[model samples]
Target: MAVVLEVDSVDDPRIDDFRDLKAADRRPDRPGGKGLVIAEGTVVVRRMLDSPFRPHALLGVDKRWQDLAPELAAVEVPFYRASAEVMAEVVGFHLNRGVLAVAHRPPERDFDEVVADATTVAVLEGVNDHENLGSMFRNAAGLGVDAILFGDRCADPLYRRSVRVSMGHALRVPFARVPDWPGGLGLLRRRGFQVVALTPDPMAPTLATALTGDRVALLLGAEGPGLTEEAMTAADVGARIPMSAGTDSLNVATAAAMAFYERVRAS
Candidate 1:
């Protein structure tokens, strides 16, 4: 069982991992960063505890600790209990979520291993927004998408904001980086996945008609630029979600949700 330690002082060195979160050591993508995966709020913290990213410590208000007590019974880490005021002082802001957990990132999953049993997956390119990535993972989890594969210029899915926005689905849903950009997509193709690129172009076939494979990989790009021409060329087909005549495109995450729903609807 985990140990409960009372933290009355904001300067306590024991809770340093929960302090000054804006510092470089907290940002996994920045220089000299510790690459720690931070889960905020009771819900996300619970998900982190259940995920492969094992949390080493947790800091939260008494109420939040009580809410999480059942789940923490099997956990071995220290649970630092503090007042909301002291938590705010230590973390450098008022955190309404009332809880935080920190874990070291596990080794990245292998591309082949992630896709080995996946019947449906989403491949991303240049989708840099952390919120969008989070929403994408949440949508994938809810809609039965098997895994997510990253292409070129994509944001780190384990980033703190991404994990929080995902409601912790970023930790639950399996994902791996696809090497060599569009070229790496060939691995999916060779594995018998029909790569379908989502686009705004009206000339392309609708998703309903374009998706015909037993195994499918949907390719999506950044919001403004959409998929690069090279990525489109690599796909087996280009498909579009029907939209109102005036709108040129949808938000990347929204578009991804629609495509994911299509896959579920078909299955």
Candidate 2:
């Protein structure tokens, strides 16, 4: 069972993982660094508790502790109870969510492991924005995307902003990094996936027409630049969402949602 400890000081080293959250250099959740996963809010915290990332400790107000009592009944970690003012001081911001849980990142699954049973997958390239990456994970979860594949230059999906925006779906969804940019796409093709690249070019076939394979891999790039020519060529086909004339293009996450919805609609 979890032990609830009342915390009166902002400088408590026991809650150090939840401290200096906004400090880019010292934050424990940064990728390629300490690699901890931080879950904010009750919903995300609940999801984190149920996910593979095990929470080491939690910092929240009393109300949050009561709200989460059922979920934490079996958890053996410490729950540091603090005032909202003290939490704000410790985290360097006014966190309205009133709850935060810090978990250590688990080992990453291999590409083959993540896709072994997937029928619909999202492949991302140059998606460096944490919010966009989070939204994509949220959309993928909502639309039933089986897994996510990271190509070149994508941001860490476990980044704090991404995890918050994903509403904890980032921790639930299966994802893996593809080792070598466009070249790694060949592995998917060899595994019998129809790699389709989403693009803004009107010359390409609509998603409805292009995404016809039983096992599909949808490739998406950054919003403005879209997919690279090399990536487009690597894919079996290029697909676009039908849009009204004169609109520039959809946001990367929005575009991904549309494609994922199309897959659902088709199914």
Candidate 3:
């Protein structure tokens, strides 16, 4: 069982881990980070406890702590109680989430293990926006996609902004970075996953027609550049989402949502 701590001063040394929340992500001495995985709100903090990331300590307002009593019932960590002003002082801003949990990031899963059971997966290349990555995971979780694969040049999924943007879904989704660039795509084909490259090219077949396979893996690229020719040709087929003419292509995450929608619709 965890102890409830009464903290009156913002300078309390016991709550040091919760201090300097902005610089906490930097790894000045540790291997992966000094930046422990910090969950800002009640939802994300709950997710951190449920995910591979385990919280060492919690800092929050009293009401927030009371609200989290059930989730923290068996947790052996200290809940550092503070006022809204102190939390704002420590976190460098007023956190509307009212609660924060800090956890160490777990190891990354291997590529083979990540793809083993996925029937529908989204593969990303150079899709480096943290928000996009977060939205993609949320869409995948809600829309029934099995997994996500980072092809290359993707953003850090565990980044603070990404985690918050994902609404805690990033922690639930399983992902692994692909080893080789375009060549690693062959690995999916070998696993019986029909790899389809999503493109904006009107010449390509519609996504509804292109995504016909027992196991489907959709390849996506960054918004402006789209998929590289090398990445596109590497896949078995190129699929296009039918959109109204003259307007720009959908945002990468939105496009991924549409594809995930198609998968759910098919099932």
Candidate 4:
């Protein structure tokens, strides 16, 4: 059973964890730039509470507290109740989600641990956009990607925006960072994973033919740049989505979704 403390003033220091959400440097969630895993809205918050990332505190209006009563009964945490106006003042914006849960970032999972027992995985490179990273997690979860492996220079999937965009899927899907860039791809290959690089090259083999392996690892890159030459070289084969001629390349997340769908279809 959680404690519901009614807060009439936004200046209450007890709710500091929910303060100045938009302030890049000062936001409690963004402590030292690596923000806490923040779950906004009832759905995402419920997912977070159900996930391994445990919430330390929550802030929202009375109605949201009532709405989350069933879920709240299972956790022993503090719920800071505030009006929409006070919440907007404290968080630095009008958050229509009406509720927020803040959790400390959990330890990163080991690459081998993340991929062990997985048949399908999504490997990412240079994907710095938060929204794209979130969407990728959502797609991976939806289309049966077992885990997400990060290569180099990827965005923080635990960021608030990413969590919201992912509809809490990021919290549910397991992800890990590969120690080395292209060099680390050998780990997957050694594990019998057919590392397939996704590219825009029309000459490359179609996903249907390229993804034939007992275990498949789909490598995706940023939208404009796609995969690097080194990354492509590291893969066992290059795969394309078979788009119409003259059309631009798909967004990285969208491209990954198509490949994920193809993987499911073929299985």
> What lDDT tens digits, residue by residue, belong to model 1 across residues 1-267?
888999999999998777777655554333247777889999999999999989999999999889999999999999999999999999888999999999887788999899999999999999999899999999999999999999998888888789999999999999999978899999999999999999888899999899999999999999998888999999999999999997768889999999899888845
The residue pairs found clashing in candidate 1 are none
Off by over 4 Å in 2: none
For all candidates in order, the CA lDDT equals 0.90, 0.93, 0.85, 0.91
Q: What is the TM-score ranking, best to worst?
A: 2, 4, 1, 3
* lDDT tens digits by residue: candidate 2, 55-142: 9999999999999999999899999999999999999999999999999888888999999999999999999999999999999999
**CA RMSD of each candidate after superposition:** 1.5, 0.9, 2.2, 1.2
Give me the runs in candidate 1 sitting further than 4 Å from their true place: 23-32
Q: Highest TM-score, which number?
A: 2
Q: Model 4: how large is the Cα RMSD against the reference?
A: 1.2
In model 4, the Cα lDDT at residue 101 comes to 95
Which of the predicted structures, 2 or 4, would earn the higher lDDT when compared with the native? 2
Q: TM-score for all predictions?
A: 0.96, 0.98, 0.93, 0.97
Candidate 3 lDDT, 76-122, residue by residue in tens: 89999999999888777788889988777777899999899899999
Q: Where in model 3 is the C-alpha error above 4 Å?
A: 23-32
